[model samples]
Target: MCTVCGCGDGEVKVHGHKHHSHDHSHTHSHSHDDGLHFGDGAAGVSVPGYSQERLIKIETDILAKNDRYAELNRAKLAAQEVFAVNLVSSPGSGKTTLLCKTIEALGGQPLAVIEGDQQTQNDADRIRATGAPAIQVNTGKGCHLDGHMVGHAIEHLTLSHGSLLFIENVGNLVCPASFDLGEDCKVAILSVTEGEDKPLKYPDMFTAARLAILNKIDLAPHCDVDLDLYTANLRRVNPTIEILNLSARTGEGMSEWITWLRTNLAQKQLQGAAE
Candidate 1:
């Protein structure tokens, strides 16, 4: 079990109580650049309700700005008629391998990939081998991909009408769930090696995802991952989330995944034209 599983966990056990101080539900906005706003908690002072209410208003304004920008990004992508899918998962969760094989499965019809990583262009190199236009954004210390980065990436991307864009996000589950990268959908990729409880553990990711690809199915015989339980947990978080199981290395379950993309891409084009 994870160390932060429940109240019985190590950190909570140390205090003989399980009450967490607070989970800061912060969503980044175009307005807020939080340098440091020290509250009264550190000084053991009780602040007035009015001050706290004002702070809450500021937060609401910030989130409203972010929602506006997200809508703008969405409009821009829809106008360009691109089906941008954000790939999110842990560091070694087959994101790059899946991108490599996904491009290959695409057979180069007009696909571009924006690769996000802390460092290196290794994934971009893999993408290049498939003859797709790939741009690497080295976030250096960032934890996730956001709309600003994707909006910037589009300036360099050689996309045409009906081009498929894939933004393989920086490998972090939590922060990425809050940022909208102008994508038509957020695609969460979970591998069998990550285990069945992942969806329940990372409900934010599962909840945000419209579709999920359960990779590494070919390794099922060699591993003890319960596929049924995994699907059940995922469905619990997001009943409408389309699930696809595949292994990129062995080319297992590639056709279904590809077909799903093609179907979505066509539908998006149809919708864009109808508008």
Candidate 2:
């Protein structure tokens, strides 16, 4: 039985196997985690099921556990009264640069950032230059930031109440959408240089984002990209996604971005107050 949405919670007792009663509680999701182990190990003692089904089941179980932790973390964040945004973008999408500019635009406020990267502390260094508390989590080989990792980073930073926490998730759109890091919202940034077809091609990222920033509009004229089409594609995926066309380098449209941030923060604060 799967631990989440509970479907596969059956018990397993192998033939000619002697073991204590297996606890059927918390039926973890594994493709083969439905139980019933057959055959034997090299030692002639079957250690439960070890089939391909089991592997899939184990993988599902792991992700389910991650999501459970994520929910717990989200409730904790709600209690803390923080406006946390999980920002997702691809490599060279100007995520860090845009973040630095956003920090400046926000007037050096108490914004704490969690930088995620497979390697290098470059992004953290850039954020630190802006005088905000930036904690860089090096995933080393991981492509995205999971809820558990973000939870660990938040605990490490000792993030106080009423602070803006930006999680610059590892530069990937695919896996990040599946895991929530207890954020108030998820923001996705797509540079114009990446072309207008991104939203259509990467529907998951666009759909997951509460806001989609079409960055580097300063280079829009240089690229043969149709802004309207791009927006339409995104709108098709998520009709209510707030779209922002901005250039981080030229500072054009940044004020609007800042205003959006302020509004989001204000709304989050109000929600917290009401709660």
For every model in order, what is the number of clashing pairs? 0, 8
Worst 10 residues of 2 by lDDT: 11-20
Model 2, span 1-275: residue lDDT tens: 22222223232211110122211111122234344332212223334446555544555666677777788778877787778999999888999999999999899556788888766667888887887777777664456776766776666565577778899998886768767788888999999888777887778788999999989988888887788987899999899999999999999999998998888888887899997
Worst 10 residues of 1 by lDDT: 9-18
**What lDDT, from 0 to 1, does candidate 1 have?**
0.72
lDDT of 2: 0.73
Clashing pairs in 1: none
lDDT of 1 by residue, 14-81 (tens): 01001232111122224342422322232233334435555545445544655566677788778878
In terms of lDDT, which candidate is strongest? 2
**Backbone-clash count (model 2):** 8
- The TM-score leader among the candidates is 1
lDDT on C-alpha atoms for all candidate structures:
0.72, 0.73
